[model samples]
Each structure stands twice: as structure tokens, then as C-alpha cells.
Target: MGQPIFYGSVHVLFYRNDEVLLLKRKNTGFMDGMWSVVAGRIDGAEEVVSAAIREAREEAGVDIDPSGIDVVGVMHRKNTSSEWIDFYLKVKSWKGDIVNKEPHKCEELRWFPLGDLPETVIPYVKSALARNHDRIWFESFGW
Candidate 1:
């Protein structure tokens, strides 16, 4: 077999009262123009938590203390392919405003309430939020 690709992405769901930070991806790669939380691939030889913190800073220009962010669960997404995703939930905290650093990868940034989320949100993120109500931690959730 040829070289295989195994992706490890970390996502953190941040809630401010009712609304949450979401990014509208630009017309680029997968799920372009869709809304999703802070996400980025885990680098080789790097810790998973560091990836989440780095993604938050790089994607949204936010500084998150790695230890403060709680790992809600790990969802093994298998939509078109299989990949491991580490899910974190930061209920009440975070500094700096949400800014779109990667213009090529994102177009707009907005905060939507939990009760009234946009239809463009990625299916996996939607499922993550809904299922998070039960405090489900460390389990596989489909995309």
C-alpha cells in the first residue's frame, strides 16, 4: 500500500451565555463556507492538548490555557473517511475577540446562540453540541 494519511483534529466548543463562536469557511477545501468550531490537525510528535490550544490561537486569535479547557470527548468521525477528533468544551472563559486569521480558509466569523444555530454548521459539530448536554465524554460520535 502507498503512504497512509491519519488525521488527528482537535475542536473546542466555546459558549458565551447562549451564543457560540463559529467560523464560516471560505470557498476552499472540504466543507467550504460551512460553519464549524476551532479545528486543526495534530502535528507529528505533538501532544493532543497542544494542538487544540494552538488551533484556537491560530484560527480565532484566542488564547486558551490548555489545562483550563476541558476535554469533553473523543469522537471518531467516519463520514467519507475515518479520523480521530478530540473534543473539548470551555463553558465560561476565553480572551480576545474571534478573528478570521486564515482568510483563504475562512470568510466570516459570527456568534450564534445555542437555540438558534445557522443551518450551515457542520453536521458533526451539531451532533457534538446536542450530545454534549449529557456530559458525554470519550466516545465515538458519527459525522
Candidate 2:
């Protein structure tokens, strides 16, 4: 074999007080009708932090400073068809009003209490959020 390849993506947990922002995916073919955070695939040659900031802006219409975000956890996820490495970043503060920037791909954006997330959240996303960020740095899903 030459090498192994995995898709890389970033997830942003925008926190406000006791809540975290979630967007209901709509037309996205992968996980339509499920709730997820601001997220996207890393562009070629882009730094992970830069990808996080770009995703936040593209999905939620928010601007996040690199210094204001924390890489809370990472997940190595694999299913029947593909594998992905996902970085979960936490942001307690950001600029601009949060809106559904991609109305065609996302249905609506809402905030849910960190302690009580909705049942519709994406599986791996829910797993990442349930982790004790201070203690765990990585997790694996779907074997």
C-alpha cells in the first residue's frame, strides 16, 4: 500500500453562558435533519485553526479569533465507507451575530443547554461533546 488517507474536518462549539449553538442540517446529503455544530472540511494547505475559523464564519456567520478558540477534543471516526479525523474546538466568545449563513444546507440555528443537548445531534458530535474536555484529548468512534 502506498499510504492511508482520512478526511479531516473541524467542529466549532460556540458557547454562550450555559448553552452551545447547534444547526439543523437540511440539504446536506450526509446527515440531513440532524443537529450539528459549525463545521466543515479543511481546505488544502489550511491550518486547522484557520479551518475552524472559516467554518464558523461560513456556517454561522460569526468571526472567531484564533486566540479565543480551544481545541477541546479530537475524534478518529470510521464507518463502513470512510474514515475521518475531526477536531472539536470550543469558543466561548466570537464576533458578529450568529445566523444560518447557508440557509440551503442548514435549516435553523439554535442554542441548547450544554447539560441537555437534543437527541437529534449527530452521533460522533454528541460523543465528542459528552467527553470531559479537561481530561480527555481524543476519542474514537465506529471502530
Candidate 3:
């Protein structure tokens, strides 16, 4: 009889023309071999937008200004053992070149055409991208 806790995370989508950046997960115990966007959990007391900016810089070697990004969608996903609230943000512009800053956790960094994403993309991530501009603010998965 306690309040349910849903962990919060941020996902950053970097766009160039009609393509979007994606990083292949590697060596990470969870979701290894899958492609995903730059993402990480929000630290305590951190604002969601701040977390998205931080994650983009940490994972993609890019600096995103607060005004250059927008929260496009929110996903409530339930996996086998945990629930997650993931905020998907789109980066209109950023500073610095994109790179795989976390080599141990990410295998490759590449851009794919929005209309031709790879089949290996993470399920929830693909869903978010497919609906990024549909004005759908909320989505849920796995019940």
C-alpha cells in the first residue's frame, strides 16, 4: 500500500534533414544489440529538459541549448520488472560534432532516414520516432 514509483528518463532525437541519429547498444546488459537514441535516467532534483540536454552531451558529444529542444512525446512503458516514464525530446540544433562518447555501452553511431529506420531499433524508441510530429503527446506500452 505505497505509492507506485515510475523511473523517469529522457530520450534525445537529433535530426538532420530527413534523417535521425541512432546509437547501437552494446555491452549493456539490457537491450544490447539494439539501436536507440541518446538517453539516460534523470537524476534526482534535475529538471527533465536539463536531463535531456545532459544526456545528449554525455552520450553524443553534443551540447543542446535549452531553447533548441522540445519535448515531443512522453511514453509510459512497462517491461518485465519495471515501469518507466520516458520523455522524448527533439533537438532542432546543437553544438559540436556527434560521436559515440560511451564506447563501452554503445557500439555505433549513425543517422538513418526517418522513413527507413533499421529493424534493430528499440521498440519503444521506434514508436516514439514514428509519432514524433503527430501531436500525440502521450503513449503507453506493455499495459
Candidate 4:
């Protein structure tokens, strides 16, 4: 038997009033032209929550409180070539204006009503958002 291999990623959902921030993916080979939230893979020697805070700052130019981040959902997603353990965190408080810190990997940063998101959002992200609201703890995709 071979060792099980799965990648871990953190998705930070920043909400302001009734809106949620989304980054338009660009240049990134994985999900080019799709809309996603502030997210990235967990680095070595880093806790999942710490990864969330780092991604929020690196990708969106904001500082999130570690205590303010709540794991709203976790999704086990698998495709033909890869699998991911996605940590969906909701953060209501943060410092600094949200800007596109990684413009090379993203097109624009925009806020949308949480009730209605763009049709071009990555499918799994859309599902994750709904799951978070429904209080569902875990979900599987492309199994």
C-alpha cells in the first residue's frame, strides 16, 4: 500500500455587512477566470488557522484575527489527479483595506451579496458557501 496523500488549503470568507469578498482568478493555471475567496495551501510548520491568516494577508491585503476565524465547513474534494482538505473559515473582523495583493494571480477584488453570488464562481466554492450556511460540517466532491 502507498501512503495517502492529500493537500490542505484554507479559505477565508471575509464578510462586511451583507457582502462577501471574492477574487477573480487569473493567470493561476488551476482555476483561471473563476471567482474565489481569499485562499491558499497550508505551508510546512504552520497550523491551519495560521495558514488562513497568512492567505488573507498575502492574497487580499488584510489582517485577520486568529480568534475571529471560525471553521464554518470542511470539504474533502477529489479529482482525477489531486485531492484537497479545504478549511472554510469565516472572519468578520480584519484590519486594512482589502486589495488585490497578488494581482499577477488575480484580476479584481469585488464584494457580492452573500445571498447571491456570481455564476462564474468555482463550483466547489459555491457549494461550500451553501454548506457553511446550512451548518453542514463536512462534504465530499468528485468522489
Better of 2 and 3 by lDDT: 3
TM-score of 3: 0.95
Per-candidate TM equals 0.84, 0.93, 0.95, 0.93
Best by lDDT: 3
* Alpha-carbon lDDT of model 3: 0.91
lDDT of 1 at 74: 72
lDDT of each: 0.75, 0.89, 0.91, 0.88
For candidate 3, lDDT tens digit of each residue in 12-112?
Answer: 98889999999999888989999999999999999999999999989989898899998889999998888899999888889999988999999999999
User: For candidate 2, which ten residues in a row score worst on lDDT?
Assistant: 128-137
lDDT of 4 by residue, 66-132 (tens): 8877888889999678889999998858889988899899999999998989999999998887764
RMSD of candidate 2 to the true fold?
Answer: 1.5
lDDT of 3 at 72: 87
Prediction 4 global C-alpha lDDT: 0.88
In TM-score terms, which candidate is top?
3
Q: Tens-digit lDDT track for model 1 on 52-122?
A: 77888888888877666767767777656655655556534667877888887888878898899999899
Pairs in steric clash, model 3: none
Q: Against the correct fold, how does model 4 do in TM-score?
A: 0.93
Please write out the lDDT profile of model 2 over residues 57-78, one tens digit for every residue.
8888889889988889989999
